[model samples]
Structure formats: C-alpha cells, structure tokens
Target chain A: MKTRDLGSAAALAILGLLAAGLAGCAPGFDHLEIKIDTLPPLAVSVDPTNVELPVGIAVGITATPFDTSGDKMDSDVVLNLVPKNQKVLAVETSLDDRSFVLFGVGPGTTSISVQVDHESRTDIPATVKLQPME
Target chain B: MIRKLLLLLPAAGLLVLTGCPVTDASTGELSNGRFAYLCVDSSDPTCDGIVGKAVIPDLLAVGGAFDLEYAGDSGAGLVQVQPASDVMISSTAGTFAFRIPGIAAMLAKNNGGVVADFVHLRGVDVDHLDVLGESLAESIKTLEMTTGVAAALAVSPRDRLDARLGGALAYTWASSDPSIVAVNMASARNSVILAGIAAGTATVEVSLRSGLKMAVLVTVKQGVPMTTSSSSGAGGSSSSGSGSGSGSGTTTTGAGGAGGGK
Candidate 1:
C-alpha cells in the first residue's frame, strides 16, 4: 500500500511539472502592442521637367517614382502628354511614350504637360520655330 | 426564454470580445476593419515599435488558408518575432516584440501610421491572435541609393533626365550647371530633370532636409557620349554615376544612384 501511494505521488508531481513546462512555453512578445510600419507616400520624378525643341527634334522623358522606403516602383508610373496646342507640339500621343518630337506644325509656342498619377502632374513648354529648308 | 437567452449571450459575448472596428489606439484611428492591428498603448510613439497589417474587414481568423509557423523552436516553444516572414503570432494578452529595420522604415507613410506595410495576412494560432505582423527597429539608419539611376547620366543635347531610384527618398534638387542641366522643378519628392541643355558636363545636387546630399554627373552630347560608362561607387559614397550613351537615349549601368536599396 505504501508503494502504491508513493507511485501516485510521483505521477502527480510529473504531471505538475509538465503543466508548468507547458505554461512557460507559451509564445513571448505576443502581449506588447506594436503598430504597423508604413511606406511613405510615393514621390514621382519627371526628368527634364521641361523641354526645348527647335522643330523636328525628339527628346526622351523618363519619369521615376520614389518611395521613402526605396521600393522600386517603375511598373506603377504612368506618363501622359497633353499639348496645349497640338499644332505647335506633337507627341506620340501614347500613355507610355515619355519622348516627344517637336514638329513646327504652325510655328507657335505651346505647353506640354505630363500627368503622373491620378492627380499629380508636370508640364513642359515647347516653342517651335519654322526652320528653313536645308 | 432563459435557455434561449443563454445561447444568444455566449455568441454575443464572443462577438464583443472579437468585434469589428479594430483601432490602432496609438493613432486613435480606425484600422479600417483590419484583421490584424497594433494597439499603440501610448500617445507618443517612435521608431522603436510598429507592426504590419492585413486587408481583412474583421479581426476574426479565416478557416484554413494560413501557414504560420513559429519563429524558432517549432515544437511547442515560445514564439518570438520572425521578421523575415510577413506573418506574426501574438496572444490575446498581446505582449509581442518585433524588429523594425530602423527609423526610416518606421517613418514611411501608409495606411496612416508606422505599421501598415509589413504584413499581408493574419496568422493567429495557439489561443493567441496573430496581431498584425507589427513593426520596425529603434534607430534612424542611413539610406543607400542603389540601381535604376546613376551619378552621371548621358542623353541627347535636348533630352531630359528620366530616372528611377532604387529606394524612396525625399530630396531638394538643384543644378550646378543649369545651362547644361536644370531641375525639372525647384523641388520634387523623387524626380530630377538634368535637361541636357547643352553639350557639357554638369552636376545635379539632391539634398534631403536632414542634410544628406548626393551629386550626379550629367553629360549631354549629340553623338556617342563623351564620358566613360564606368561605375562610380556604391551607396553612401559619392561618385560620378557613369552612363553609356548610344545614338537615341541613355542607359544606366549598376553604378550610381541616390537612394539605399538593392
């Protein structure tokens, strides 16, 4: 009977130890509150924000988008050219072409603006002059 | 009526305990019903803390699409933060510690605080709500500019400086040789136009409000670029970024840029 009693006590002690070990194994750092890290508002860069052409000239415009965290975002950048006077300045008129060729269509000064995002934009003013036949 | 009332009470209690409209208490703004969130305990917070977020409309766990594992000791050991994976595990008690890279990572703007860009899903387990894979480190670290841009870019005499940064940076743009190259604007968050105004070598200085500065060389020519396309140096060092000029436009190699990144 004494041996039986001792065996039961040993079993209970082992169970208690197991319980304690399990409790200590609970995940740490689960209670302290932490907030999410954010990425800064994206910045759009239009290289050569302005351009000058003397008719029959084409220039390449590259728009780079910068994130404060430095994540590359070239895939998200959009470029559009809106010529104040289509006759004075002519672009490929595609959303992807950052380059525009100046055609002395009428020899007038017109402004070309490129839309970056939904609301942010930049412009380039072009003055076209009629060149004499070479 | 008592039996019916009892059934509804438990369900209602569960709902209240895990309800919608989770807030970031630190910012005191709604977390837009995110499944995970950071409970900013104090009014003032800094780069020391922050977590990630998810796009869930409520804080409840999903049925079975999760694959969260412990950061270490996979077998029944205490789970610390595993910064590598986007998922973070936390308990109902919510005492968790995660690592943020530095101050700059925390200051990035997003869902309106310092904890919105780390995680994408909630991985709750072991009776603990995997709070948002919440946030960054406790110091301001320097940024290294990497690929996509260069210290020196080459283009046609009339071309513009169109370049992308390897990382995000806010800078004030200025042209040392405006006649050769001029800024598209006085200041831009990330854009600089080194207009090849003339056939010359010029410098474009990009400075941050914190006084971090970088100088890029701009060379414009009508024919093959006059400058060599050798790399200047890596981030944290100022070297003339090299550009290989071809007939039409310019292409940047692995050399120079003004932001820290891969």
Candidate 2:
C-alpha cells in the first residue's frame, strides 16, 4: 500500500510539471509602443517672412511636420488660428499634398497654434500688421 | 503517456509561435525633390494627350490619372475627352477639365507658353513690377501677355503676389546666365503647346527687351506632381493617410513590424 501511494504521488508530480511547461509555451501578450516626431516646430513663417501688405490682403499659413521613424504622419496634424482674442480660424489637412491652407487673413497680431496627436504647439508670437490699403 | 502528450503539445505551440517568418514593413522612398505636371482629367482633350514643354527631372513620377477637376465637372466626364497629346494648365484657378481630348491637345499645343515659361527660380533676381505705380497698367499688360489673361504674377519660391492681375501669366526661371528665362504656366493651352514643342524636339528661346532684358527658355519633358502622406499601423497592417495637416496634430497608432530588424 505504501509503495502504491508513493508511485501515484510521483506520477502526479510529473503530470503537474508537464502542465506547467505547456502554460509557459502559450502565447503571451506584449505591450504596444507608439511614437511621434515633429519635423519643424510649430511656427508661422510669412512667405516673404517679412512683407509689406495692404490692409485686407489675404495671407496663407503653411505648416510642415516630420517623424523620426521616417513614417509619414501628415494626416495626424492640425492647425488653428486665433485672432485678437476672438474668432478661431480652423484649418483642414491635405494629407495627399501634406499641406494645409489658411485663407482670408486680415493683418493683425494673430495667435497660430499647430497640433499633432492632440498635442498643441504654438509658434513664437509675432505681429502680422498689414499696411492700410491706399 | 499523458505527461508526454502534454509536453509535446507545449513544444508544438512554442514552435508555431516562434517559427513564424518575419516581414519587413514597406517604407516610403524619399521624394527625389522633383515634381511633375499631371493632367488627371480624362475628359479634358489633353488627358495623356501631349507632353508639355516643361522639362521635369527624370527622377520624378508623372501621371494625369489622379488629377482633380473643377467644382461642376464629373470625374467620369473628365476622363471621357482624353487627349491624344500633351497639354498644360495653371495650378491655380478654374476647374481643371480632365476628359476632353481636344482640351488636352490644345494644352499640348500651347504648353511652351504656359508651363515652361512660367516657373519661378529661386536665387535668381527678377525685375519687380510695381503694380501700384505709373507702370502698373503696362506691367499688368506685359504680365498678362506673358502668363495669360487668367494668370497672376507671383514672387518666385513664394506664391505671394506683388499685384493681382486680372488675367493669367506664365512664370519661368532664368538659367545660369540671365540670357535664358524659362516660364511655367498652369493651364491646358500651355500643356498642349509644350507637347507639340517636345514632339518636334525643338528648342525655342525668346528674349523680351523692356526696362530689363529677360530671356525665356522653353524645354519640354515628362512631368509629375510630388506628393507625400502619413501612415498608421495596426496589427501588423499599415494604412496610408491624406490631409492630416502637420506637426502636433499628427498621431501614430497601433502595432507594427520590428524596425531595423532587431
């Protein structure tokens, strides 16, 4: 009786070790990683950088983005323009062209912010003063 | 027997998981920093009709199949009037007709005046035409004749205008010597002219002597528009995006293949 009991205990231990090995081999999940990089910091650059324009002239805002992994992230970018603490200028993305256009801008100090992945980036504040149309 | 079976099953599962072949994700090739003029409208007589007079670099990809049309044009209708020759049209203004073969042919016939003569060259000095002074009207006329009634004159490298003319104008660059000026116009007439010029293998140089002498060089070759876009990876599959904007608004989501093979 004692020998039979010892034999049964040994068999159970061997089976338990096999089951543990199988569990270890089962597929295990790994954490996913996502990253992003900006090509040029969000900023407003006048096409001429500096220009004399008549009042009520329309100016365009161009923004570009870059990624470290060499991945194109154009679709994930956004642009917004706030004028004189009133009226928000929202821009639409042209991912195919990797560009956005902000049209019909009147001269004044406007706050421009670029957002990517929900993160907002504002350019160094600059005055956009337009010359009064003669 | 059961113990051996369990061990074997674990080993088999491990083999299945670890032995899968890895795949390298497709990556975008850096644009050769080149552009092409594509007439995407098939209905425009110039769809694949003629090769415009613009000499696009050889490293670029040029096609008109994906070009967009004006507000009231149908995508299918534009494709119907496909051109048998080359054509050129303005990048700005008016709906681009894609289906008229006659339109394409016309563009190919007139491409030299519209596309090649109109491109702006950086680092080269151009005589600035003051649109507000006494010379404004004459300057506007010269610009209109050079570009077209619908074309506007813009500062090179930057599209900002010193003045907005009522019509079109071709823009071009002067070669190393101020002796050769090349203009590019974005229009169907120019595209057709370019195709005709390119087919004849002719090299035409026109010099306009005014307050300042400027030379225009006309060369025709294949052209393609340069385009770039973003990507999103999910579960080992990747997708392309359009008009995501730039900078902080961009997002990269999901799992993807290993980078650089680690």
Candidate 1 CAPRI grade: incorrect
- Error at B52, model 1, angstroms: 16
Give one digit per residue, the lDDT tens place, for model 1 in B173-229: 676755334455412233333334334465666554445455555565423323444
User: Model 1: residues >4 Å from true position, as ranges?
Assistant: A1-134, B1-169, B186-188, B223-262
Best by lDDT: 1
lDDT agreement of model 2 with the native: 0.26
State the lDDT at A1 in candidate 1: 100
Q: Interface RMSD of the predictions, in order shown? A: 22.5, 16.3
lDDT of 2 by residue, A1-119 (tens): 99999999999999999999996664322111111111211233343122222221222233444444444444434433222321222222312233332321234454444444445
Best by TM-score: 2
| Native interface contacts kept by each candidate, as a fraction | 0.00, 0.00
